[model samples]
Target: MTITLHHLRYSRSTRIIWLLEELDIGYSIVEHHRDETTNRSQDDLFAIHPLGKAPAVDVDGRVMMESGAIIEYLIETHGAGKLGVAPGEAERSAYLEWMQFTEGTLAMPVLLTMLGPRFGGLDKLPLLQGFVGGEVTKLLDYVDAHLEGREFLLESGFTGADINMEYLLELINLTGMLDQRPNAKSYLERLMARDAYKRAIEIGGPLVKLPG
Candidate 1:
């Protein structure tokens, strides 16, 4: 059965779209348009998942929420070991750590940094924003150094870990944080150079928007 991906434009669901393209598996996309004003997903999304979030994938008969969880499930079910590290294998801990880390650790400052201006109230305190910016730089530095001599996150080559972590890097690039970190910027370039990434972007529609 072809899986159904509920994709929200300008959202992190692009990760799942890219993963499906990389897996070269058959699936269908259900595009959900975001509110042009607020840039939020439609309330109709709640019919699929309570959170009304993007990337609520329909796997056969199951509805999966969360981009990372959907990526994990797809890789495990269809990737046939090409894109995921098994639980007991070497680098499994790192794999799992990074899989969770993208959303758990890295996303906070990345989103906070972007949303600070939108959310306002923090604009007056450049010091506070500067502090958050420092944390963002720290996170990018760690990722850049780690990716210095490697093409993929794991020694095993590209895995779901890359799929999970890459969207955050895309966000970082959008914020222009990548300019200072050549390695991280190059990492985005490398990942985007893939035919799958390009196809996914085409399939999901362009993510680029007018800068805020």
Candidate 2:
């Protein structure tokens, strides 16, 4: 099947790119920018996704949006019997758990904390920022504690869960929100060691500027 990923570099879309590379699936990418003026896409990504979100995928001819949904679809269709755990396997349960945790819980709080500063002034934003940041940190602490003495989030080896979590963890680090957690730091390092992630970085290099 021919897959087309509509993505923006360095955004949550990177998770999709990493997943594709990990699965070794052949796909094409359509790169676009989030408009500086509106802080959204200049193009009609919303025509494909009502929210104009990145990381939307066109599988064959059908379009799918939302990163978590996109990842689940890819894994279920192209990744089953291969990169992911078999159906009804215990690892499959664990995989779904981590994937939902990463996107639904972990990423939501972190993203809210990030937006607090933009929507409210720094001085006034501390309440929401602290609330969201505290929740995200708590979740990260749980994950960090769980990951201790283990190599991956689920199963005996890497899976889509790790790919999902790694990007969120990196976002936390980039925001200077995770420095106090040593296990998270270590886990982030291990994630960076993956060749697929390195390739994603190379592909994304010129599309978005990394913060120093």
- Cand. 1 Cα-lDDT: 0.84
lDDT of 2 at 22: 83
lDDT of 2 by residue, 60-119 (tens): 899888777787789888885655766688787887788788877787887776556567
Question: TM-score, each model?
Answer: 0.93, 0.88
Determine the C-alpha RMSD for candidate 1 after optimal superposition of all C-alphas. 1.8
Q: Which candidate wins on TM-score? A: 1
Name the best candidate (by lDDT). 1
Clashes of each: 0, 0
Q: Across residues 1-212, which tens digit of lDDT does each residue of candidate 1 receive? A: 66998888877888888999899988888888888898877777877888889888998778988777888889899988888888889988988888888988898988888778777756678888888888898999999998898888887898877877877788768778899898888888888888888898888876656567
TM-score between candidate 2 and the true structure: 0.88
